[model samples]
Target: MTGPATDVWTVMSTARTIRRFTDKPVDEATLGRCLRAATWAPSGANAQEWRFVVLRSPESRAVVAKAAEQALRVIEPVYGMTRPDDHDDSRRARTNRATYELHDRAGEFTSVLFTQKRFPTASELLLGGSIFPAMQNFLLAARAQGLGACMTSWASYGGEPLLREAVGVPDDWMLAGHVVVGWPQGNHGPVRRRPLADVTYLDRWEEQAGPTLVTEAPPS
Candidate 1:
């Protein structure tokens, strides 16, 4: 952890949402390091309510994978119901394709991390504030160890009782997110993003500031 090899910015910048994985398993020691990194994330008033469930057993993963598949079957139509005329067909189709691809390979993950924490109180906005940072830490730690990872909430939101019961999560806890981790099948690289100047604002409203060349535009 003492060289450019462990630089924080390098790790953060290189972390990507990896979906495809190889059959190699993640060793127990590496898993411990990732979880330990998550524990160091800050929490509200140090309440530190985040909890994680790791599934490596094929039987258990199958249960969750089946739930994810069932969930995807209904997502597009559910979005249409919620938005009606405003639903974007092209965007929805793209999302559907991505969801299906993940579902097809769900069982390949060497480890699946289920994140949960106490439900937020009415007074608090962004209830996931405490939990998500910890989840990010978990992913970054995995990335640093040369493992690929991805985080999503389809199981929590769409799979519902099936997923909850399979994992034995309590009703009092909200499912924050899920992360899939394993050896990547391909090389990793920096993801595209909007130029920082286009997204960042200065002292005045609508005023663009910061370096304009932070990233290149995605391919058209």
Candidate 2:
């Protein structure tokens, strides 16, 4: 288990997005703990309005997976539109291959659908502000506990309606995203990300230098 003071910088630095997972089942107790961690996340006015729908049963997983596949097929043409001709063809090929692998492996993991009651834009931002921290905590906790998980939003396309119907999500609720969790079967490593300097600004939003640091520094 990761200690409370395991060096905040180190924990943040080591976290990575896990895509591939193993067939090992995440136990009920562990899942509950993960949810508990999520609930601890801050929310708008401490409203804690977030709701997590865990899809564990084989039947439910099948329904959601089918819906996801259907939605992906519908969006494939649009995905092509976003790709540029100058893009790295090799990288795109690898990404496409991974997408197909995820499709085939989708049924093996548990799907968690996160939601919140619909709110106006400002309120929604506050609500999201609260939920995402908790989500990141959940992901970090999962990584610490040796579980592989990845946050994905592909289900939010045209599949939202099907998901709401299949999962019995309330009419007043809005889907945030889906998180897939399972034990990892393959290698997990540092993810490629832009440097901090390229993203962060000193004072104003646009005031940034060249790439700050490519890889995160380990805690001293």
Candidate 3:
């Protein structure tokens, strides 16, 4: 298949997380392309035991949405997320509002439940090295298709059992990640990042590679 109509660098730069979606339908072909990209991600021992479950039916999505609701009880407090004052219009406030919308409507969007085979010798973190790259590919592929997407921590946030049973995932597989995909109700632009040099280090951890701009300084 031809590469997506977007440049690689452009896709990477613009592939920001999207939460709110319209009622527009997402076709199977588009999703298949994203999954195809996912299969190309590297895995340990070339033991590609990753499995993906597509949750599109209203019933399945409702299951996820409900779990998301339960998850927020833990997430909001730990993260210190307070309801943004209606008059507040800062970047953090906007992000908070979108995040809340996602939690409320997660089940209404098409999502994928990614899982990896569990082995006696492999810890979940070790297995994540095998599976997360595939999820990255899926995210990039979705962006290339001009679809919006974001990885969800609903499972890790205490929704794993409900999601696993709802999707009938086998016990031998660990729930690696989950992502929501759909036509975006938002815009995609250059992703915000710290100056590369500040984040990147040279040969030694003690060495500063570049001028350290105060990361928390107010934007000019």
Candidate 4:
């Protein structure tokens, strides 16, 4: 287990979203640890309405991959479009390109953790507040073991019906997302982000705080 002395900040700073994974196998014991961490996350009123279904068999992965491809076909066009403001064109293009690349490679990972939750009624729009944190906890736990993972909501796009039936999830449950995990085909490194000052605000909007996200210099 990773201790407090392990510098969680560093672990968090370098935990980039990994899409291209190697052929290395992730054992059951390792995945169980990640699930344990996920269960420790706080949920709305302690309801903990989350459920994780692990997909390992090639046939199962193929189903998910096909569903994801359908989702990409529907979503990629939106990402490629020019936003009304036009200021986000470049970012949109990059995202579109990444999704395009990830489409064909989705099924090749070690495992896909299917995140699901009880269906939320119109009154409970905040249901995601409980499930998303658990997903993050699982991701960070995998990162601690030098594994790579990425969370994708493609399951909810156009393939939700097919995926729900294939995964054998009941109608009362809704898909939260999918987390694909495995060893990386490439190295893990720091993720790019805006400077903290640009995003942080003090007591009021535009009242900025000092940067708290710092990284050490690389060896020469």
TM, every model: 0.78, 0.81, 0.89, 0.79
> What's every prediction's RMSD, in angstroms?
6.8, 4.9, 5.0, 6.2
Q: Please write out the lDDT profile of model 2 over residues 20-67, one tens digit for every residue.
A: 666678898778877888888787788887889898888878876786
Q: How high is the CA lDDT of each candidate model?
A: 0.69, 0.70, 0.86, 0.71
Q: CA lDDT of 186 in candidate 1?
A: 65
Task: For model 1, state the Cα shift of residue 212 in Å.
Answer: 9.4
lDDT of 1: 0.69
Best by TM-score: 3
Better of 1 and 4 by lDDT: 4
lDDT of 4: 0.71
lDDT per residue as tens, model 3, 34-144: 999999999999999999999999889898898789877878998888778899999989898888888988878889999999988988898999999999999999989
On the 0 to 100 scale, the lDDT of residue 144 in model 2 is: 61
The pairs that clash in candidate 3 are none
Tens-digit lDDT string for candidate 4 (78-103): 65532234344675565554455567
Tell me the TM-score of model 3. 0.89
Off by over 4 Å in 3: 1-5, 210-220
- How well does candidate 3 score on lDDT at residue 186? 70
Best by lDDT: 3
